[model samples]
Target: MNGCAAFCSPASTQPALPLTLAHPLAHHSCTMFFKILLLSAAAFSATTTAATTYKASFTQYGSTDTWGSGNCNVASTACGFYTSPGYSAAVSQNEFGVGPGAGAGPACGTCWKLTAQTDSSGNNLSNAGNSIVVQVTNLCPASGNPLCAQKGLTGTNQYGANLNFDLCIDSGASNALFGNSGVGLAVGSAVQVDCNQWSGEVVH
Candidate 1:
């Protein structure tokens, strides 16, 4: 007979309404308080956890000219791509571990082969894989002038151990790009056309 009486009445008298089971909005104060408590707990948990950061840095030398095609003239020529049509750069990748020691512990490892694509980026395409390294161990003591190379692997012929480092360029990949940019093609991201130029192409 009554509207509000039939809805919020005692459970014993009613056959039970289907709408009450799926109700999202709460008219009562208790439901609202429960939601607030849940939210506060979630916020506290997020604030206490540490965040992981990672970056992949790389340096590549692109080979353009077959031989010495460009003249040494610094004026009109300006040692440009016509002379050196490739580029090189340093890339870095970092991961956050479970600790506050600041980059100390068992040590992580990473290895990379230089990948190249024709006028594009993402997933090294075009088959010109020239890997390179930042070689920064010697420069470590020199202040903010080191590289993102394999840790514990520097000086002598230890480039093989560079697999532990987050960034690296293998001998095979570098050889391909060292040939001809117009032939093998240019990798998009780290290799800029003008900035990190390279010398002669890899001879066949």
Candidate 2:
């Protein structure tokens, strides 16, 4: 069993016994055991591969693309409103898809990043200044897709429609009092509120 003879002999698979071969028989048993070990390893590898999930979410900062129904104490085309006169840019009536590209962002869609702030009333949540968490699922793939393996989600607005997430906001923050994650999107932290993918399942 220790030397090469046990492995190369033509009678390696059988017992080349004078009466009952010792070394060759032991080698044959070892070969069978090795095959079993290999098969078990293959099975474990296949199981691990089958159990893996390959979906991802991205976070980016954005605002409503267009204004809906609002009269913020600002110019004709602006978004949320700041309680203080300072940081007027922080406030606008526009939706998540319509902000005029804040903080090194795309005017339309370079990266639909998550804004870690909250908004409400078709707008970001006020004062609490938390970002929204929208979870878009599935994101059906298609040829010529502008977004594939991209890093974030984008807001959409063609008409006065609510261009929301593909996946519903399954759950949300509870920063109702301006601390410990607000009820909606956070202002400066990441939230999962955009959808490259979506689920058909809907519930109010």
What TM-score, computed on C-alpha atoms, does each candidate reach?
A: 0.22, 0.22
lDDT of candidates 1 onward, in order: 0.30, 0.29
Candidate 1, residues 1-204: lDDT per residue as tens digits? 244334443455656444455234423433556578789989987766433222223333222334433322112211111212222122221111212323322222111223334332434444444444222110111123133333332311122222122111222233444344433224322311211233333211
Distance from true position, residue 56, model 1, in Å? 2.9
Q: Which ranges in model 1 have alpha carbons more than 4 Å from their true place? A: 1-27, 48-52, 58-145, 149-204
Candidate 2: C-alpha lDDT: 0.29
lDDT of 2 by residue, 1-204 (tens): 443345434555665544245466665766776788789999998876452111222111223223232322223222221112111112111223332333211221111223333433333445533333332211212123222222223322221122222211112212212344333222233322223332222221
